[model samples]
Target: MTQALPSLKDHCRTTVAELIRICQDRAVRSALRPLLAGIPDMQIRAMRYLPRNAPVNQDLLYLIAGLVAEYPCSLPEPNNVMSFGASLYKLSQHPDIKATGIERRLESLLQLELDSLMQPLHSLVVQFSSTQSSKTSIVIDYATLLYHLRCWDDSRKWVQLTWARDFWCPKEDGKEQNSDETLDIVKS
Candidate 1:
């Protein structure tokens, strides 16, 4: 029989080290120095590969949660943030991990995103409404994000607005789609 492959832990560690090296490159560091300033060196080193590692290990999840708590403003790039969130979402759905630890960090990250938006509900509504073309999916996403953030009043307002728009606006096929299911999900 052939020798077994390296353990996942060892593979992850090597991947993380290579990722750290990329982050530490002179040109990369020069470009990212300002963004990295407030974050602790150790946290930055771990966070550079968090999107890759967080899905595979609980320890990495905890480390990332701690780093986010310490440096709420030091958000990763949008793509990385999306990947991180997706990983956490997957982990949170696992029966073994559900409600044990990952849920809390996922909630914290959702709150962090809401806090980062930094605009009141009225402003967000106005901003999205004033655009020449409104994307229903984006409106729904914002409403869902607010719901997850526990901004009940704001979320309700958005759901109502979105429902009204869906009802009143002419559909491409001249038929109105019921948005009650979407509204119910947000209300919950």
Candidate 2:
């Protein structure tokens, strides 16, 4: 069985010869086919090798890596998903990237948006005083929450949350200033 195995040089030569023959097939224009067929055989065979483990010259490896992975692509950035960044970007951009677990993020953004819509929420940075039996009350900023829900493309809920319209950003120096926080929305 080992004796039947062809030498690397012989295999390389045979591959080049076959490729040259295929490229020169009569169906194609004779003048152009021969010129295009002139590519180095070594390069063609390299495709077969590099693709396995990114196995050099391996067609399967290269082609497989070139494809898109769907579901996981919808996940947000900086979480550092995917073996390659470019591939991850391409995956996210795929048309099939539907609303998966993004609803939870939507919920989070909605809460934030509601907080933002309300009056520049008291940050309690400059503490004044605490009352007797100082109860720690937490206010859910529903208005800002609605804004995030709106931004999340839950436009159907727009009518439901429409009656609730308010947006306020805190300011220093008594001047209008853009809020420092923003939720970057990505369409899934």
Candidate 3:
């Protein structure tokens, strides 16, 4: 009998946790500085620690690591609650975020193709961080994002559809829809 390979999601979760741990040390955190520049450079230092077997390519992983590092505050893996799309939705709904402004940004995000996703996505995440109230820290589910980036080329385009659903779907009973359920719906 052969052993099952680790799922990409699991790999991503471990990778993210390790990055956060390594960043806890000031020197190690400083090494990730290449990721902070407006445009990502191929020489990002954190690439050494990220798993090479991830479904997403090294460049995408580096971009994700940069985004995650932006939030130096506590990084807790929530129960599939705060995905990139869901977090954007929450940010769009924040009283401080003007509806027209956020709506335009969300539109641009939803329209991106895989080749064009990185920069715009980075900008949107930075926008979310800046526009959000100080009382609440930024939250983005990097593990799921890794999986989505890998699946960006799916014929059904489920990843983009899921993000659109999360952003545009009407809230039911003042509650956000479960992100997994939203994805399943997009898949079907």
- Model 2, range 53-125, lDDT digits (tens) per residue? 2112333212211111100012222122111212212222334433232223223333444324211111110
In order, candidate lDDTs are: 0.34, 0.25, 0.65
lDDT of 3: 0.65
Rate residue 2 of model 1 by lDDT: 100
Model 2 TM-score is: 0.17
Candidate no. 3 TM-score: 0.78
Best by lDDT: 3
Q: Sort by TM-score, best first: what order?
A: 3, 1, 2
| Ranking of all candidate structures by their lDDT, best first | 3, 1, 2
lDDT of 1 by residue, 1-188 (tens): 89997653344434333434444445443433332233556445545534353223433332323322222222222222112333233333334343344444434433433334322322222322333142321111221222223332364554334433433343443222334455466556
TM-scores for all predictions: 0.21, 0.17, 0.78
Model 3 steric clash pairs:
none
Best by TM-score: 3
